[model samples]
Target: MGWAVARFDFSWGDAEYHQETLENLKAAIKSTKKLCAVMLDTVGPELQVVNKSEKAITLKADDKVILTPNQGQEATSEVLPINFAGLSKAVKQGDTIFIGQYLFTGSETTSVWLEVDEVKSEDVVCVIKNSATLAGSLFTLHASQIHIDLPTLSNEDKQAIMTWGVQNKIDFISLSYTRHAEDVREAREFLSKLGDLSQTQIFAKIENVEGLTHFDEILQEADGIILSRGNLGIDLPPEKVFLFQKSAVYKCNMAGKPAVVTRVVDSMTDNLRPTRAEATDVANAVLDGCDAILLGAETLRGLYPIETISTIGKICAEAEKVSNQDQYFKKTVKYVGEPMSHLESIASSAVRAAIKVKATVIICFTSSGRAARLIAKYRPTMPVLSVVIPRLKTNQLKWSFTGAFEARQSLIVRGLFPLLADPRHPAESTNATNESVLKVALDHGKASGVIKSHDRVVVCQKVGDASVVKIIELED
Candidate 1:
């Protein structure tokens, strides 16, 4: 039995090109079953001002500015109405404020930088430090003791999830600005109310100081953690952000949860090609053992989204190719789920066997996708084929391939690939045969070209009588 390929058209208005790419991708998968899933990044609840200007207003250094609690009001050098009313009280004298279009130009000119001079009941006075265009953009309040009560899920965020995410079968939801485990719990609770808990996984985006402070607790509930470098840089110094990224990825790897590094190629948003620094950034994230790198505005609203994807994909693939296996495997990862100990152990042993035999692939038969996650935690060198049976889980896993939830679930983990297959197919499985899994793997392996005639393959499953894992030799 063959699964129908789900296709999505990007917002770039290249429908014909999109269709052709989809057809080509499907054809390749039909013949070789090897496919990389690409996920589109959706806008989440990242706070920004609602600009009412037709164009951005440029502000020079020393220009006086006003932070107000109104919206749809034009922003000028003298006065700017901000959407967030709390901003006036959340900042103090000598505080730094960053306002902008969320572009990581690394140039202070893209965003207005200000030093707060005084605070009023509903307004704050500031003098511009840099020349920048003040438009509809979010600002970062740089103060040690300031508190901003940003909601975990904004109304817009909820609407987007209910419509775009659920209706389109989005695989992973990355919760932006997650402050604590409670925030994750709230999102899950909200999704559960919408009856979408099982359909999509939640990835907590660790961006701010609070998120960093409660990182450990947050991981317990988060399917994955996305190190949001852009916003993180605002909260912490760039050097510290990089350090935290490495540290967070290490923790995620150790816990067996997927860790993603986002904004690795922010410069790609404007340039057709990546800068030397951007290229090195992507490679370094991979070298640091991140499961995936996220392309933010580079793909969301960039000039060359497809090219950016191709470029980053090549960088990651090459980096992994030459990555040090010793460094990759030289970690003592503790399993995240306590109840999954037995299954985790089984997964561990299977990874070891695959390495010992230098197996070309590891095929896992799963119902709830747990086995796939367990095996992925081990970070095997060879490709992984997680054969899922449930229809919803299958669709969800397909979304994961798209990097929809790069931090938590991804097709970029080493060589992991997930697919939907029937355990009851006559050519691959049957009620009369207890070798359903073996036959399924053989058929899928051959079709995907990952397994060929006489190729060594490792199969992992928990069928009635089959070993959790075993070495198998393919035959023509």
Candidate 2:
């Protein structure tokens, strides 16, 4: 007699809060399992100054502003209370200050741009380069040979990682404003201390010049990279943003890491549908071979969050249908490190085998999610279903996909679906055997209409001390 097979199940109630937006989100994920991810935004402990005045503060050809370290301080027409301490010590007379690419050069400068005429311990006076306004916007100080040392992870970020992340078993944690490889390492170390490194994967947000400069190094340490264009546009030249995003996504693929293009639909925040430009932007990212397209403000705070996700998913699926599969795989293949190369070879073989045999699906039983990601990196035509063990990893993978190794690192990669594999009969071993788990995966796929009787299935799993790949003919 054949052994009893386990199955994978997802409860809408336990998935997340019950709401129209969330329900729609779950349906979207179910439809686009391999290409979608849900990101929960969090505000870090870092504080910035905001204008207390409701009105915009316009600066003409010349305007003097005060930089005070007063919290909740009111702003006047001439004095702007900035809460950054040591600002006067860090900036000099010729230093340039930028508010969303608006330049304000120092007074000792030669150009007619905004010049800092005077620098006090707590205040700096500047002459505006042109008529500009500071209406509660984020600003950055740019100076030659100037370095700003900020915390890698803020206190609030730490608290959230330990509290919300641990409690919910989130699949991936995206570190915002990551400046260096050290930042990624620091975040991993923090997660390690919190006992989350094994289950929660980390994604580095490459948004600024500094992060982009050290992207390769950061990519080596991070599970994936999120190309955040909104923040990149703030500091980088507008014309170079798209080029950088495309280049970054290509590089990540070459490195065998998932790369996500983000903030493609900023205009959909208020509109019921995406603008023509926004729709085109998303389709272009998909054509660029991005593993995933991320929606930020448009899906989180936007009036039509469900519509935004639904629209983006449809666009991505359509783009994928028309994309050149052979070219996509060729672009992603390049020289990689030892273990990665080995795993990539395994995944590549599975894809080839499935295609040759006309398999319906590729089923992977993963403890750390590597087996699943390796398969996804190949961008196979058949849907890859990951039977992730450890109930925590299952729940976490729902958000993206994680354990002994970094969890759910391949959550957003193309053509990968993660499911929790639960055995009805609990065994003593911490890890389940490959044969038993494969049975579970097959059973779940059939019950979910992903597989039919006599369907060909490609199975990939890591057995004790060795990796196993097999082709199985299912029966009723």
Tens-place lDDT per residue, model 2, 106-205, is 1122112345777876777766766665553433334322334557577667765676566545567778777799988988888777754445667887
TM-scores, one per candidate: 0.83, 0.75
List ranges where model 2 is wrong by over 4 Å.
1-47, 52-67, 89-118, 126-147, 196-198, 333-341, 391-410, 423-439, 447-449, 452-455, 473-476
* Residue range with the least summed lDDT across 10 consecutive positions in model 2: 1-10
Question: Poorest 10 consecutive residues of model 1 by lDDT?
Answer: 1-10
| Clash counts for the predictions, in order | 6, 12
Over 43-140, each residue of candidate 1 has an lDDT whose tens digit, in order, gives: 34354555555456788898788877767566677777776777776787998777766534456777767789898888888898888765444443
